[model samples]
Target chain A: MTETWIILGATSSIARAFIRQEAANGSGFLLCGRDMDDIAATAADARLRGAPMAEAMAFDARQPDTFAPILDRAASLSGAVSVAVFVGSMPEQAAIDADPAMIAGVVTDSFTGPAQFLTAIAPMMETRGAGRVVGVGSVAGDRGRLGNYVYGASKAGFATYLSGLRNRLGRSGVHVMTVKPGPVDTAMTWGGPKQPLSTTPEVVARDIARGLAKRRNVIYTAGIWRLVMAVVRAIPEPIFKKMTF
Target chain B: MRWKEMELAGWGRALKSTAAVARPERRSALAGAAAPAIGNRRSYGDAALNGGGKVIDMTRLDRVLELEAATGLLRVEAGARIGELAQLLAPRGWLPAVMPGTGFATVGGCIAMDVHGKNHHGAGSFGMHLAEIELIVGGEARPIGPDDPLWRATIGGLGQTGIITAATLRLIPAKGRTMRVREQRVEGWDEHIALLDSSDASYTVGWIDATATGARLGRGILEEGEISDASLPPAGRSRKVPLDAPGFALSSPVVRVFNAAYYARVPAQGRTVTRAQADFFFPLDRIHDWNRLYGKRGFHQFQCVVPPAQKDALRDMLRAIAQSGLASPLAVLKRMGPGRAGMLSFPMEGYTLAVDFPNRAAARSLIAALEDLAIAAEGRIYFAKDSLAGAAQVRAMYPELADWQAAVSAADPDRALETDIVRRLRLRDPA
Candidate 1:
């Protein structure tokens, strides 16, 4: 049976790496992203790498119109349809602080935008009832940090939404996995201070594959982040507020 | 485009640079991004380094864009790896015409170096098989072919003419994914050369024991290979060198013992085996970061080719390397054809010798001595493997350097593409 992955934010480093791995396994792809050129390039790469079928389409988290075409395309394709959401934005804390109104965009890019799309596709996935949904959240969602609490809060909200979605979909045979990755060496972390225990997108992609196979919910990549985040979440609010990462 | 500050080095690790690097996954980001585009950083010396400057890492842009199986023509982005291409196409009975010792080498690097493969005597260098080249010139992408005036300079041009973005290569068809190899022990220098000259196999190369002296000098194994539909087991997982090995790990005594065991493994009567294509072509690739075995200080590879008439000079060079007791176990000898696409291409209708030496004052002097021998024998040292060659010595070796410089100067008038190797060799300056 053919398995088509409807990948959102397809141009993200982690998404690209994940697509390559899945392509080699003969899975097809619907690469949806804002930059059609970049998505098309990745689609071509995916097809050449062994994907049975790969196509590119426009998608923007902030735009609802863009979401319908992708979901419609997924509906048109036969066989099992999976979705992987690798969408999110992280503007610098200083930049967000300068214009407090930027929080709306952050929430849209990270939380509400993807959640709305998932809600639209949830029924279709439940009807078929045999596929996986991988939502890439950040470890920052485990608890708000002093550095960039707004971005963290957006991811926290997204994580909660995925949790509720998983609860609703588990009975229908559709698996929803929430991936909490630590700092990945992507464009977002390129010029920043060396992040502790930072891993590559390829590593995170492999971890997601492993987690999906085990039907994991809310897994931390690099595995060590699970314990690290546990320690962070346990700290009292009084002590945590005084601390800075 | 976000430019990140990074400290990078070539494979040799002897020369390093801190540069602002932009890694663009999209082709659109390549325009007006940076100069002296680099891929994989597989070059052993300064060819890939741009100290205190800016560079665009092209590895992320790699993709197999198109393929015409009937014509055996494959179009790929410049950053695509040769080994990956081989792995992808070999099952379909096709492969890149030329692959270097390491599979990690990128197509752009292969064109810039005009790299030769084990089948050099038959297929020639990588550029000879190229049908089309797409270069980023003057902030715009331009497609050119072999008939273009810039062809000679761009191939083996050390990436001086322009930033290579993509190419259409005429890939060769393969009979199968397995390589049927024949191995034999060559007892001495003369016999080794004679055996290589007599061999008519599709692929032929000799592994030299650089530590061998006197009668055993130049003694090693000669491997001849041909593609066949023979079944072979899957390859094992690759192992990586976790850290820099201690100095004693590759000392003279240790190398001698390792070389001896490696030679003995082939046996006196020799053996025939069916091996994976990658295992036959890129034996060292199974050991990731093998350079770390040379220790923290790193090492240098001296590769030079001399005319058939200067065989005695090569023998003397080998004798010197053997006597120095500084040579690493990684040594290779092969006979090359006179097929070269670019003016500065390293191939000649003669014998080529390559040996690795741990970086030390003694090894440095030995390499310098070998460079002089190469120049004296009317031979040229490979720029891809050279880090110590003086400008005057290198200039004397490549007679067509003037022609290449003229073409490069016209293509990149601002000299914005000049790399450390270009500056170090003074390649574009007036003689």
Candidate 2:
């Protein structure tokens, strides 16, 4: 069946990589993001690469008013519809510490805003009985480290929410994949030390597509991240608090 | 490879450098980065490296902005791979007019190096097909076309002019998705150069065996290719070296044996076959990270072009390569037309020879000797494949270096976009 993919936060490096792969396969893309210019560029690229349908729409996760129009546009298409969320933002830990109000925007950008949109479309996916939903969490979500605990907590919350959503939607033949990526060379991870074992956005996109194809419930990019997080999660609070990475 | 101090190298990986790199995916971010922009780094040398400075990795910004079927024109982001463009346009009966040997090269890299391909004898260098270049020079993005003096400087400017954000390319009609390649085994250096000079095929290259001695000094495969409508089998799955190989992996004895085996694999009886375009264009790409096959230290590619009259000098260099006993399996000889688009461009009406050797002291000295031979012949070594030539030697080779430097300095007064090769060779200064 022809698949239509709704790419949220389409301007992110990971989202851009994922859409290119999908476009090559002739899948449609509804590129959602606040940067209309960026989204329009990606849409044009997708169409050039042979995507059956490529369009850009304004989407601010904090605003629900922008949700229904995108959903309505996606609903007009006659095909299995899937959604992949790559929407998330992280402020400096110190910035968030200094201004606790920053936590609301982070949670909204990373979790609650995307969750609300997914919640609105869950019924459509369940009714179709074959659509997939991919939620991108992070290795940070596995165990909150001292470096960026607030951002970690938001992703952690999102992972739990995706878990419950997966359980609820699985009965109707809907599949949900939670992707836990390590240090991906994306704009989000910009301005840091070049990661030792970091994977590219293209690699992350490939892993997510592979996970969807295999119908995996949870997957970690670079697979090594799975082991890395395992060790992190195993550390006691006393020892972890003393460590900074 | 983004926003971090990472050790990197050109495809050769012979000279390593640490640079803080920014990999921006969006077009808007391309101009804002305070660094020189680099593509796939296909140059086999330090041309793409920045050493202690910062660089902007432009691979992810690859997106096709515009395509004109009527005019056979394509505008793509600087990061777009040429292979992807070929795949996209070939199906539509149009392809990039000038594609380098490796399709993994990006538009930005192609323009920076002003690369030449197998069909260079006919199509000229990559810069010849340029329609316009969008360069972020001195913090402002501007379009430079053929009429502009800066155009020639930017084409082969080695990213010294500024960051190439997007470029409009002029494409040609492609007959099909396959290349009809005919392979003939040449017996010696004389026969090898003769075949390269006389071949009428659109694409011709000689795979020289650098380990051969005396009579068999340059004996290897001579490949002549023509674009064909016939298609071939799809490429097979790629094999990857999962880990770093031991130092002895590409030892002298092993390369000798491997080169012999590779040359013999193609029968002396000669054979003609159709191949997937990529198979013919990027012969070694199927082996992912094949550089690891040489182990972690990496390898160096020595490429130089000598005038047609300097065949004796070329032979001397080949003899030097043969004596070193350190040559890798990759070596090629081609006859280039004088159809170059930029001032510092390497192509001239001459015979160009390229050979690879693992990064070792002996190999370095041998390459240095070959570089001196190229200079003595008044022939220039390619900046794209050079990691060893000194500034004075490079200056002597390209008489137009002063013009290029003046244009570059004007375009980037602060020199924010100068890469390691530019700095090492001191291309920005004529004196």
Candidate 3:
């Protein structure tokens, strides 16, 4: 059976690396993203790398109108129709503080928008009774810090939603994984201050593949992040509120 | 991110640069400025560095867009590694026509340097296999074909003719994924030259012991390989150089012992062995960050090509290196065909010698003397490996320098694509 992956936010660095790895495994791909040009290039690369089928489609997280065509395309394909959501946005805390309106876009791009798409496609995945859903969240979501709490809050919501989705879909033989990675050396963190123990997109992709193979739920990349976040989450609310990262 | 400030260096670690770098991951993102673009920065010296200016990092843009199975033509991005391409295509019975010594060398860097491989005697330089190049000129993509004069300037032009976005390469049909290699010991300079000159294998290379002198001069191993479909165990895991080695790690006595053991490793009668294709081509790559073996002070590699008639000049140069007691274990000598695709391409009908030396005052002076000898013999130094050649001496070596300069100047009037090597050698300046 051909496993067709409906990759959301296909232009993200981690997503691109993940797509390359899967393409080599002879998987099919429906690459969806805002930048059609970039997605088209990745599709061509996937085809050359041994993907059985690869197509690019327009997808904008802020607009729900773009989700149906992608879901319909996945339904038209045979075999397992999996989806990996790498959609997220991180505007500087200072920028969000200046304009509160930016908060909505952040939440929509990271949480509500992807959740809506997944909610619409859930029945299709359940009917097939075989597929994987990989939702990429950040370690920052484990405990919001002063640096970028809005973005952290969005990922936190997405992570929580994935936990519920996993419970609902696990009964039907589908797997849902929540990946909480620390700062990855991608465009999101490129020019920012040096991130502690920051890993590359390639590393994150490899971790995701390992997590999927093991059928693990809620795994932390760079595994050190799990311990670090554990200590952070244990801190008392009063002290944590007064401290800054 | 659009840009990031960082310090980078070439493979030799002898030259450093602090620049604002923008690593665009997509073709659409590469449409901005006509800045100098660098791939894996595999050049041993400053060929890929631009001191305090801006540079475009093309490593992330690597991808193979298309492969025509019938004609064996591959349309690939500039940042794709040569080794990765071979690994991807070999199982399908095709390979990039020419691959440099290190598989980590990117397609763009190979084109800019006109790198040669063990098959240089037959397949020629990397640029000779290019069917078309999608070069970013004046912030727009333009396809450059063989008939265009810019084509000559771009290949081996040292990235001065604008950024190379992607290219169409003519891949050759490969027999299999493994190699049948025959290794033999050669004693004395005459036998070494005789063996290299007479070899007709698809891939041939001579590993000379740079520390040997007198009656044993030029004694080392010669490896000739042919692709085969033989089954072999998977290669072992690659090891990494954890830290900088001490100065004595490659000292004269230590290197001599290592060389003797390496030479003796091959039986006195010689033998044929099977090796993975990558293991045969990129032996040093097995040790990740092998450059750290040179220690913190770094090292320099002196590579030069002299016409077949100038054998004595090369021998004298080697003798000088042997007496200096500064040579490292990495040294090579090979015969090249008269096949070059650029005005300043590095290949000619000659024998090329390359030797690595720790960055010391004595090594610096020895390399300078060798450069002068190369000039006297009408030979040329490889810009990709040189870090100390004088500007005027280099200008005299390449007769077509003026023509390259004219084409490059016309392509980049503001000199936005100039690199450290281009600036150091004064390649764009007319006498």
Candidate 4:
């Protein structure tokens, strides 16, 4: 059977690489992004890479209703969604300091909205007795960083929600995965200061594909991030608070 | 040997006779004529069953084929049990890197399943250590190495490619008889993940009860340990279980109570150290029809590995099980090692959880649901313990399925060796 993957936030460079990889691996995909034109470009790229099928769908992560129709359309085209990759969310620091309206939109887009979208499609995946849901979280969610507490907190909530979703859907045959990518050099973090463990979108995308194929529950885009997080989590809170990133 | 006729899964009860087969010692006796072979029947699927075909039970072929301690390479007959090999090698300061839950499984069976153990997150599958497999392909015994395409096919081929007569396994130097075991109980799912995420041990495993709900859902015992070379001590020999117990033994009430107590006995706190054998590899020889406790219907085990990217998915899985009300008594979670090259191999660097459900009629749906979830996650089921996963799902889960099938087909075009599972999965075209 031809496996089908639905990529949320398809415009992201990492998501683009994931689409290319899946396409190269002979799988079909539905690319969903904020702009229809961007998704169309991605679909064209995926199709050129040898994807059995590739299509673009306009999506706004802030709007949960947009997902229902997209999911329906994917199902109508294919039998079911084999994998769903969510990579749409606002930057961490901006969401934290933004106005109440901006914060609400960030929280919804990052956590609540994705949760609703997942909740909507999770049943269909479960009822079909097979599917995978991949949520793109950040290493910032590992702990509250002073620089981006708001984005980190939202991602933390999303990561925690994915954990609960995984537990709920485990026995039903639906897999939910949370990806915690360390500092990735993407549009979201373009101007951000380069860190010791900053990774590229291609690297994160490869790790995501590998993690998805393995059905891993939580994956660090770069394996080193696991160790980095371990050390970060181990530092005494008093000591951690004094250190500047 | 009919699985349906024997008791299994640690309950010491007997199952009704759905099928039976007997192979006398004479039939299994090694002949000078190229050593005729048959697939190990331990496979849960039809890949091991040869419809009325003459099956030379390799279990009796139990003999040390080769052992090179200096090179850390040991070749043993297909019939040699893993427990037997462990006992033989443990004293020689060597041990198999990857061992499945049950030592009763034969070396060939391990290779067929590409079995993984608690240390899989670091050590990969049993097939990774397989230097080469000696197989009887089309009436000829040929040694296939890792580089050979047939090697990958047979490793996790479910015995579809050929009859594995012997295997040259890679062995690791043992540190000692003692193992420093540390046990801890995490409060919530997030903490549990954090704990697993943090630990780097030779062996690590978590036992959780899916029936536990709310804050207690993912709560369970986490045991992490490493071989204690400094505290080396002479190991004591173990006694074998000779026969099956009578029916009516190990009732559901008794098991439920025992399970409850076992879960309760675990202290809700940090770590404790214990003996290596007891900690890393206990219950070694409790293999007397352990599955009988589920009664006559038998049971199905759902084992899947969720990649780290999909780690949160496990929470959803746990919740679904709790809601389903299946009441799985034995649920084990562990971190798997890196991926292997076996076409149908189950290795994925991630966390794997295995749960057992009694073979009630409801179990069929539950198993199917679990399979679907695994596939959706892009996770594949362990073929060794699975009896119900459909062929299409299996193909979908394992991306290397087509490659493995092609290799097996190329190696044995005539399809000389066939089993019930191979037929069920249509591993080979119908003759």
Model 2 stretches astray by more than 4 angstroms: A122-130, A167-173, A191-198, A222-245, B242-251, B295-297
Q: What is the C-alpha lDDT of each candidate?
A: 0.91, 0.88, 0.92, 0.69
Q: What is the descending lDDT order?
A: 3, 1, 2, 4
Which candidate leads in DockQ?
Answer: 3
lDDT of 3 by residue, B1-431 (tens): 38888888888888888888888877787775778999998798888888888899999888888899999999999999999999999999999899899999999999999889999999999999999998988777899999988999999989999899889999999989999999999997899999999999999999999999999999999999999999899889999999999999999999999999999999989999999999999899889999999898889999999999998899999999999999999999999998899999999999999999998899999999999999999899998898888799898889999999999988899989988888899999887
Say which docking band candidate 1 falls in. Answer: medium
Q: How do the predictions measure up, each by TM-score?
A: 0.98, 0.92, 0.99, 0.57
Candidate 1 Cα outliers beyond 4 Å, as residue runs: none
* Ranking 3 against 4 by TM-score, winner: 3
Candidate 4 stretches with Cα past 4 Å from truth are A1-245, B1-47, B229-257, B276-279, B282-284, B429-431
Q: How many residue pairs clash in each candidate at the backbone level?
A: 0, 0, 0, 65
TM-score of 4: 0.57
Interface Cα RMSD in Å, per prediction: 1.4, 2.2, 1.3, 29.7
Local error of candidate 4 at A132, Å? 69
Candidate 1: tens digits of C-alpha lDDT, residues A1-245: 99999998999989999999999999999998888877887898899888999999988889999988888888998999999999999999899999999999999999999999999999999999877899999999989887888999999999999999999999899899999999998878877778999999899999999998888887898899999999999999999989988
Question: Which digits, one per residue and each the tens of the lDDT, describe model 2 over residues B1-431?
Answer: 34677788888878889998888777676655558888888888898899999989898878898889899889888999998888888888888988888888999999988999998888899999999999887777889999997899988888888889889999998889999999998999989988888899998889999899998998999999988899576678978878878988888898889988988889879999998888888888778778777777888999999899997898899898889788888889998988899988989888899998888999899888888889999899998899888998898899888888888888888888888998888888669
CAPRI class assigned to model 2: medium
lDDT of 1: 0.91
Relative to the true structure, candidate 3 reaches a TM of: 0.99
In angstroms, the error of model 3 at A59 is 0.9
Model 2 RMSD vs true structure: 2.8
Q: If both were scored by DockQ, which would come out higher, candidate 3 or candidate 4?
A: 3
